[model samples]
Target chain A: MANTGSNQVPTADVASVASSPRPYLPGDLAMWFFILAELTVFAIFIIGFAVTRQLYPDMFQQGQTYLHPVAGGINTIALISSSCLVALSLNAIKHSRQNYAAALLGGALLTASVYLAVKSWEYNELIQQGFGLSTNTYFTLYFFITAFHFMHVILGMIILGSMAFKTTKGAYQGKSLSGFESGACYWHMVDLVWIIIFPLLYVIN
Target chain B: MKPFGKMEYCWWTLIGITLFNTFLGEQFSSSALVSILVALTVMFKGLMIIDHFMELRHAHRYLRLMMRAYLIFFPSLIIVTTFL
Candidate 1:
């Protein structure tokens, strides 16, 4: 394999590629922009939640009382731990340690499963208590935000799981860190969103 | 070419810190101060994810700049809209 001085292709080729206006690579600038747009959408929802909370602080507080902070906190730990595993997996890929990467990815996947299980338990408890999405505006927003995050977590898991499979198959043998890098970036975004959501919804009361 | 050294230590340290903060945040709801502290802890966790996990520390300068901008602008926009 040719050792390019930097990870990026040479400047001359970059200029030519830029001048042609070719589409960015998958998981490139456009993808990042798409992620940013998604982030903006979630931010708007959060702002809406904040405004509603400001308007009816007591009801929002009451809604918080119904939430299981211990469970929520446990979920936070789970996600954080999963994020760490994903990060370690990427590091393993970088070092060409395929087996280590596979192991880390397995750990991450397990953590995701645990996250879903805990979330299911929490949802079950809330549903039993008649505090579901239809319960109130706060519950509505709560479910919406968390459900959106859950979808991302599932997607991240799929992506990481696929990467893990490929790693075991020697797909990333040399000079291809993009797959792991992209997965890490995506998983970090997943973890970051949870960090914001946990504080805004659970701890701030 | 592992992006980070001390992988196991870093991973466990971050997990420990997050769990500690989460427990403290949930158990004691005496003041907003605790909430802020918890948020800061989460923020630190985020920094670790970006720097070590995402290998942003090893990323190109332009990419790093873009990520930093996104992190700042998105949250700031939300906070401002909340007040408005």
Candidate 2:
């Protein structure tokens, strides 16, 4: 169906799909399904968090003041950086650099690890002050929402970690980078969710 | 394979905008305007990741449409529930 005929017959389909900016998507289609489904769940949770915050504005405001915005902000930057590394890893694999892609994935994993460490510190402080999940409306939503995203970050890291191992194993050569793309897509979703969470819970007091 | 592609550029932009948003939110803590600005910043950052880092800029028409729809839908939820 591709009449342009790039002359590279073996990779013609992929090249055609890549060249056409429409009617085709990147990576495995099933992964997109999962990404959309996960996003829908988080969207509902976020809206719920907002409605509850509206109901108890004073509680949310007070909770926000007690929490450390700097930690959240730093985690935001860390996740953003990790997502960037994931994107770079995808690019590296696209250019047929398996080792380079693995290295980039390792970097992404390290950045995410840092985010979790800082988050654990924040959780420790909150728990020390007796702000458990049952503390109040504000702390309840805060812990639940952030914890949900926190788990996703760990899952993203696991996916990235496996991708790194496979890349190092030479599983994804020039045209077989779908696995890496799928992992990167999920990582970016984690980052996107936190982008909203940061402003809503931490900044918008 | 450029050393610094558009994705890197988009990442840097996300960082700068996020820091600016934090500064504005802190500076205008009492003003009603900061919430709107924060919502907008959140939306913008989501869009940047969807379109650039996720490489959906060249995705299928419906996929691109749906992702952008969520970007607007979710962030607008935040803004709406905040003010109304």
Candidate 3:
């Protein structure tokens, strides 16, 4: 049979559909899935800790007494400030303000350094008090969670520093801002995680 | 793009709020309540980051729907498993 107009969908409509912006590209979706999986893993750890705390309220309270809230509070501010700097850097890049972008990255690096310094001080204090990873269940959880977060902070600083270097070298000038964008997203996620951990681990008791 | 500065201001405001909450949390004696409040603050911050910083606010409707689906569904599952 001869092809009829009634049987044919419009090519323009098909083209429009194909050209429409998808909710996520393959890479973005994959990255989001990876983050979700990582979040679930941390959730499991949180739930386990909650259950244990329920079982040993007194011990957990005692554990809380040993934590320094001042240090924890400082670290919270540091992470939040770092997130702000990264975000500002992303905005500056979008605006083609290379100098400002570099400045923001420098700010982020400085904040990360402060965070690490305070963290080391806290760790040293804890160690001096004999509260290592092997100390007890509470200490184990504390050390593991904070250590994992510290590693992320270090990673985020490296990413920010690299982006700064690229900006100075005139990279990311015309391309889509996806690289800096994703790095900022990941850094915010790191900050978000620490926000939860701050209260749960230190201030809660 | 037009409201980029506004978005930045909002995010900075959120950071300020979170810092305030952090200070308040340090003063609270009840761990559970403090933890709950802190969680809520962080959730708000997360929403701001996703909506503004990630540029998801200007995304297509279907994409927003999908995001809402993920946000609601996964947390629900976790809560169900934890409670029941």
Highest DockQ against the true fold, candidate: 2
lDDT (Cα, tens digit) per residue for candidate 3, span B1-84: 223566568557776865666576567776445555555565566566656544556454664565545444433333343332
Q: Write the per-residue lDDT of candidate 2 for residues B1-84, one digit (tens) a residue.
A: 567557778888899988887676566573457777777888889899988788777677788999899888877876676557
Q: Model 3, residue B41: displacement in angstroms?
A: 2.3
Tens digit of per-residue lDDT, candidate 1, span A37-107: 77778778877887887778778888887777777777877887788888777656656688998998999
* A107: Cα error in model 1, Å: 0.9
RMSD for all candidates, in order, please: 5.9, 3.6, 8.1
- Greater DockQ among 2 and 3 belongs to 2
Off by over 4 Å in 2: A1-18
- Candidate 1 total steric clashes: 0
Report the alpha-carbon TM-score of model 1 versus the true structure.
Answer: 0.81
Q: Show the colliding residue pairs in model 1.
A: none
Stretch of 10 with least lDDT, candidate 3 chain B? B75-84
Angstrom error of the Cα, residue A125, model 2: value is 0.6
**Can you list each candidate's DockQ?**
0.37, 0.67, 0.34
In terms of lDDT, the best-performing candidate is: 2
lDDT of 3 by residue, A1-205 (tens): 2222211222212223235554332114444555556566666767677667777778888988888777887887787778777766766766677788888889988988898999999999989988898888888888888898888889878888888898888786765455666567677767767766776677555
Segments in model 3 whose C-alpha atoms lie over 4 Å from true places? A1-30, B1-8, B31-35, B59-84
Docking category of candidate 1: acceptable
- Looking at model 2, the pairs that clash are none
